[model samples]
Target chain A: MPEITFRQAIHDALVEEMRRDSSVFLIGEDIGTYGGAFGVTAGILDEFGRDRVWETPISEETIVGSAVGAAIVGMKPIAEIMFMDFLTLVLDPLANQAAKVRYMFGGKATVPMVVRMPSGSGTGAAAHHSQSLETILMHIPGLKVVAPSTPYDAKGLLLSAIRDPNPVCFVEHKLLYKTKGEVPNGEYTIPLGVADIKREGTDLTIVTSEIMVHKSLSAAEDVSKEGISVEILDPRTLLPLDVDTITNSVMKTGRLLVVHEAVKTAGWAGEIMASVSESPAWDYLDAPMRRLTGKDVPIPYNRFLERAAVPQEEDIVREIQAIVSNQY
Target chain B: MGSNKINAAYDNEETTDARKKAAELGLTNEDLVSMYEVMVEIRHFEEMATTLYGLGKVHGTMHLSIGQEAVAAGAGFTLQDKDYLINHHRGHGHFIASGADVNKMMAEFLGKETGFCHGRGGSMHIADVTANNLGAQGIVAAQIAMAPGVGIAIKMRKTDQVALVIFGDGAANRGVFLESLNMSSIWDLPVVYLCENNHYGMSAEVGRVSGKVPFKDRAEALGIPGYFIDGNDVLAVYEFMKNAFSHARSGSGPVFVETETYRILGHSKSDRNLYRTKDEINQWKEKDPIIRFRDLLLEADIITVKQVDEIEKKMAKVIEDAVEFAENSPEPNIEDVMEWVYA
Candidate 1:
């Protein structure tokens, strides 16, 4: 095992999968000769050649469409939409065609394609470039949506998504690309629809994903000083959500708070809330489920406002304190 | 004049063999009669849908493939049970021509539970997997890119089935369609790119908007043989599609069939016929594929006028029955809203 950045883990996953299966290929804008926007597939073209690592036109729709075509023909295509904000241009093929093809064709057709998008805000990419739309993808059926918070999960999840029998939208947080964690060197897979309990607690369960999971975990450590044991649950897969893990955590803690970088209005937090509220965990609740999400507005360019727009460590700590204090 | 007669006599033999082959392939007699009825079935469905839209029975704007019936019928008839088809917004003709349950398609347009997508998908998103017709998409050229993928799957599984992708000339300019063509050609996938060059993309004429090259020529450049055909001639279309399908099934790769056709109605129900000349519209109407095919069958003595009438009556009854079935079907259960979210 070695400490690797989230970007390295993704690159390793591509390298391993491409070597393991000849059908695996990479296609995106600036991915081939130019590496990638975030450098996740940097040096892959040199390793895999131009055939496996395909440089595509600036068209986002074509990137997704070509991937879908290649994937259907038994080529495991890993398509990268440079920015998550640009995903709107190609959602028709992803949501309607790639996602639904298998089910629509009575499980006869499989779009074994992975669409990797660098998502979230940190470097002032403005409103257009920085937005978390994981919930929107989670809303679509027949799609496996993943948001990995660590280098370990990123490597394993990417491998699993590539081998998946359905289309997967792998949302890699733009801010987490350089973040490092211990990632195993050999081939490994983290099954989709499973939740990982990063830290265990009995007071309150903090359900979050992607970079927010790291924020929540850091806040959990600080919140522990005040005698509030915070349980952190990362739902790596959004679509086939780890509802059972989430419910079990909530049942043990007797309280829940969901945090995400996506906007509060109709974010994936709503689904998490609704799921827990309707589940057996409802009987164990000491307080109403709380949601600490990004403010319901475009991410402002100002550093402070952009930081305040999403959930920060302090925000998670304060929410935990409020829940434990039982204060209105 | 007597010497010209000798040359005419010599050419007649080749023409007679072509006619005979076309007849054997269900392009004549009962098959021709059935195809005409199918075209009329789609025609009446579009007209009724248009009327329904005018009366506010339908909610969204719909693109009707009214004059492009032969393209749908001809290409659709070639599809077997295992073959796949991806259609565009003007896809009701494709759906009906491919044997989609008519009433469910109508019910879907009406937003009834009896609709194909259980009323979730309206006119622009009707699909029947049982018929191997992948759903119609509202996005231009999105399905064109996807059809090649299905073709790839068929080829990978060592199946002889082909995927038929139907898009408009407007969609031909889309990057996804071009990329799909490039991939299909390189991989030698079993797919057919059927471009219905109806001369207009909503309001813009194809010649004015397109980059001054015929869509077929573009396909040819991509290493796929492009066949530009009179989409109004069902027999010619059938012959061309058969050859294309064979080439694809035999692993020779994809073919582009640019069917030169027109939309008899406006882009949608709301569109008035103000974009083009009424004379141009009448010209295409005079060459109506359904009527033209009917005449060809009658002239060849493959079918009688009365036989054609009977087929039309039977098809109308079938459509009527489908409508009744849809009307009587139940709406999807409220809990089912979250049912298909996984699996």
Candidate 2:
């Protein structure tokens, strides 16, 4: 096992996948020469040459669309949009073309492409660059959305996304890029749509992903003092949600709380709650299921306001504290 | 006015060059008539599709390649199965030219199970992947952006295959089209973006494009060769495409070709026929590609009037048979709605 930064894990996954499959290639703006807007693809161009590590013009639509085209023609293209905000410019290609091509073409063509982008507010990148868009991607029927909180999950999920025969949006929190974790060297992959229970508990079930998973873990520690055992379950892949695991946890704990960095309205938490409510787990609820998400406002540029926009360790602690209170 | 005014005539320098080159190709009367038959097939197919739409047999919206038969026939003739083609809504002609089964295409248009897309996709979504006609997209310039990747794929696989895409002049205005041109040129991808400029994009005229042959501007900026060809002449299209393919095969990079053509009918069935004057439509009909090519063959003694009549009769039967096949095909199974959602 290697203790590597999330950025390094992503780089390793890309390097390993590229080496394993000749059809795999990288395309994006400034991904070559400049490394990347975030340096995730730091030195791939030097290693793979200009053909594979294509440094494209500032054209998001064509970049994604071309990747879709290449993928169908027997090439696996890994396209990067510098920031999550820029992925908006490529929605048509991804939502309309890449997502629908296989179905529209009667499964005759497959778009084996991965679009990677840095997301979430942390470094004061402000409204545009820092936002969680997993909700938007999850809405698309044929797309798979993944947000990994640790270096290990990032490496494994990315490897799986690259090998999967579909379009995958590999979301990376900008703050997690430098966060280090134990990532096994060589080949490894975590199955998509599987949940990882970060810590076992009996009193409450806490479901979260991406950066929020770290916050929820910290909150769990705070609630542990009050004799309230808070279980934290991370559904790494949001689209093919692991309802069985979450439902099983809910049945034991009899309480559930969903947390995410995205805005509260129409967030992915609603879908999780809906799935839980629809399943047999609804009968096990001892307390009302609650969700703590980002406020319904654009993330601000100031460090203090940015912190206020999304949940923090303190906020998560307080929210969980209220959930466990018998009067709540 | 003294130099540039050359109407459609044999003495015109361009047509003369076309005739001379067509002569040098050493094509026999059978070859010429065979090409003529493909054009006839495309024309007949489109005509039948229009009739079926009017009869309420075909569902969803449809766009016909009525007057643009030569472009498809010529490109389809010059292209191979391994080569890729992603076309616009007016792509039924393009697919027919590429040898896509007209019966299945009609079945798809009819929303039948035996259709190219299993009826999940109607006319606008026909994709015969087996023949490598990548597919037809409903979005105007969507395929233009995506088609370049096929070229890179061919280049990566070390194959000489080229990906051909034909879009309307309206699509040329899309930002992705410019991006695609720039990217393909920079990567030297073997793609040819053929802009079918039919004078009008929907109801807007080509004069509104604001630039004189915008493809030239993009081509010059991107350093790719751009050609302006006569879309009504199949021989002219065939000749220019040959050179373009040769350039792509030589790894010279992508090419932009603007085919000056017209749509004989409204853009789609929804068109009220109120946009243009009947006289203008009648004028375009006089220079119809099928009729023009037929006359050329007759004048060159490459095909007899009787032979042309036989092709028309035979094409009518083909259209009739395709209609019957589509009408008789079964509807898709409702239980399989979730199928093909993911590969």
Highest-scoring model, lDDT: 2
lDDT of 2 at B125: 84
Compared with the true structure, what per-residue lDDT tens digits does model 1 show for residues B137-221?
7778888867655765575457798888889988987877777888778778789889888888898778777665457778888
lDDT by residue for model 2 (A152-268), tens: 999999999999899999999998988899987678899988999999999899999998998889889987888889999999999788999999999999999999999999999
Which regions of candidate 2 deviate over 4 angstroms? A326-328, B1-19
Q: What is the DockQ of candidate 1?
A: 0.23
Give, for candidate 2 chain A, the lowest lDDT window spanning 10 residues: A319-328
Fnat of the models, one by one?
0.25, 0.75
Write one digit per residue (lDDT tens) for candidate 2, span B1-343: 1221213222112443334557765555566778889999988888888888778777777787888888888788778777889888888988888888989988888889999998988889899776788898888899988977787788778988899988988888788878899889888899987888776678866665536553545666778887777889888787777778888877888887777788988887778778679998999888899888887777766778888888899999998998899889899889989997776
Q: What docking class should model 1 receive?
A: incorrect
